[model samples]
Target: MAYVPVKGGEAAILNALDLVAEERRGDPADPELTLAQIRTQQARAVDRVMAEGSLYDPDLAALALKQAQGDATEAAFLLRAYRTTLEQFARARPLETDRMAIRRRISACYKDLPGGQVLGPSVDYSHRMLDFDLAGEGAPTAPRAEAPVAAQMPRVPDLVGNEGFMEPSEPPAGDPAPGDLTRDPLAFPAPRDIRLQNLARADEGFLLGLAYSTQRGFGSNHPYAGEIRMGEVPVEVVPEELGFAIEIGEVTLTESQMITSVKGASGENPKFTRGYGLAFGHCERKAMSMALVDRALRADEFAEEPRYPAQDAEFVLYHSDNVESSGFVQHLKLPHYVDFQAELRMLREMRAARRATEQEAAE
Candidate 1:
């Protein structure tokens, strides 16, 4: 059977939009969410928006989240689209992660560290249960007693490097001008900077799936969580008139370091390698996934064969953007009457020809 093109009414389309709007604003009696509430209370969601959107304005991110009805990808899309209207004044000075005000810091590769592991606010060990109190007035809980935070913590990679365990003593501080994925069109065999930028904005769920694949032996590299840290980091930008850079503001960030054991390809001594991930907020899951994908996508750079989908840079980068991928998926709903009609006509002709051939054979 051939598919037939169905005609639609514009009135129905307009009514459907109104229904969607009404659905979004269910029960007017319920207290409406304020921008400040979303910004402060839902800080993690806002942070995810900022990180994926590649914009750090908390207030704007909050607004985008509210506008998106708490959909992170939609909020990110809103932020990313709005980011283009603003002028490109100047690029901020490179971040100094060493100076990050450590909040939640931990290591999986080691039992202890120089500064000690701080298990800051985490749901890792929490029981998954829905709180009915949240429907009304929620019960308050006292804050946990925290140990005095260290002024500075040594990076896990640095620790491993001190023990002469890593192939490259320290991760390369590649001082190259960062690529603007928004401005430049992505190309094959992308540079490391561009690849990282894409991963930074890539859909979290997509990245997570890819990362999980590697862990399940699809693209095994023997990864261990070297370190994961979340905290506020000061932003600094240099103006043309001012010779020195000045602090603009501070924003929350999550950084992940993934270490993997590898056999040297050229008969060199086997040593540990690293994959780095950094994002705009307290997003450990995203950061870890980004780190895993970061290493997986670097198969070519490491002279390793692409054994899985995660290792294929082109496959990962091209399909990673949420906005692009989501839009493409949604576009299928739009009317393609002319195109569908042509396809249906072709199918009908082919079917008719096949029937005629059968009748002639019977005769």
Candidate 2:
């Protein structure tokens, strides 16, 4: 993004910034909103910001949301900007979602699984109308369940794979470390790990739209939810001195495994292929959309022609990032006087020449 220096507008810029800050704070009569309130009350927004920002810090995400005046895309942009300043001490080991302390676990594919489908916390079955009572302070408190959710729940893919109905998700040869898009520029024909990472940090709305396109017959993959789980899993890291991993802390994650249509190569039995999605918090929509797009992007693997935007890995991966997309689109708001003038001059000259030619022909 190019930024042409203003000739002389320092005072105006400062005042503009100050006005924005004042507007963000709202009226002085109301109580100042705290970061904690945003974290607890608007947790879904924080989760979306964290997932899109590619950061898992709730407080920071909340702060970003507050600073951005609740604009989630802007909040995510602020989070990403802040993330660049922090120094990385270590890379944590991958989480085991199978051992996740189950919160809300459900499978669209199965009605009765190993551990009965647990709906920990959701508004899926709630009325769509807005509650005017909530407009006032001190709403009625929700009742709590006596028992805590189970420690571990069996995954749907594992159950289906055991029966040889689902395709095997074997680790890649040598189990090599996945490429980091943050560290390296994404190249064409990206591996599944990198593709998954791109989709994980992708914009929820964008992914959701693309996923919907597939369901509308833009693409041919009929997907089942298979499993959607949200929970906390322990984070572990190995220190050089210890040579062994130690539990650091746990971060809440939402995971989705989307089972797609069956496909088989010659001499192989047909089995259902799957797409994976993982997010920082209870973002079911984002996770589910990711799963659908992930499967669609794997057209080459399943020997399917790429006929849709979702199936085009290059198109999806490149545009999925909200920060980048927002930046590029918003950059047009910045100074473009010189460029616009140049175009204007060329247009005027072309019009003048055409008029002169018309006059000569008439004469």
Residue 234, candidate 2: C-alpha displacement in angstroms: 0.3
Alpha-carbon RMSD of each model: 3.5, 1.5
lDDT of each: 0.87, 0.92
TM-scores for every candidate against the unseen true structure: 0.91, 0.97
Q: Write the per-residue lDDT of candidate 1 for residues 204-225, one digit (tens) a residue.
A: 8999999999999898698999
Model 2 vs. true fold: TM: 0.97
Instruction: Quote the positional error of residue 55 for candidate 1 in Å.
Output: 1.6
Candidate 1 residue 12 C-alpha distance from true site, Å:
4.2
Model 2: how large is the Cα RMSD against the reference?
A: 1.5
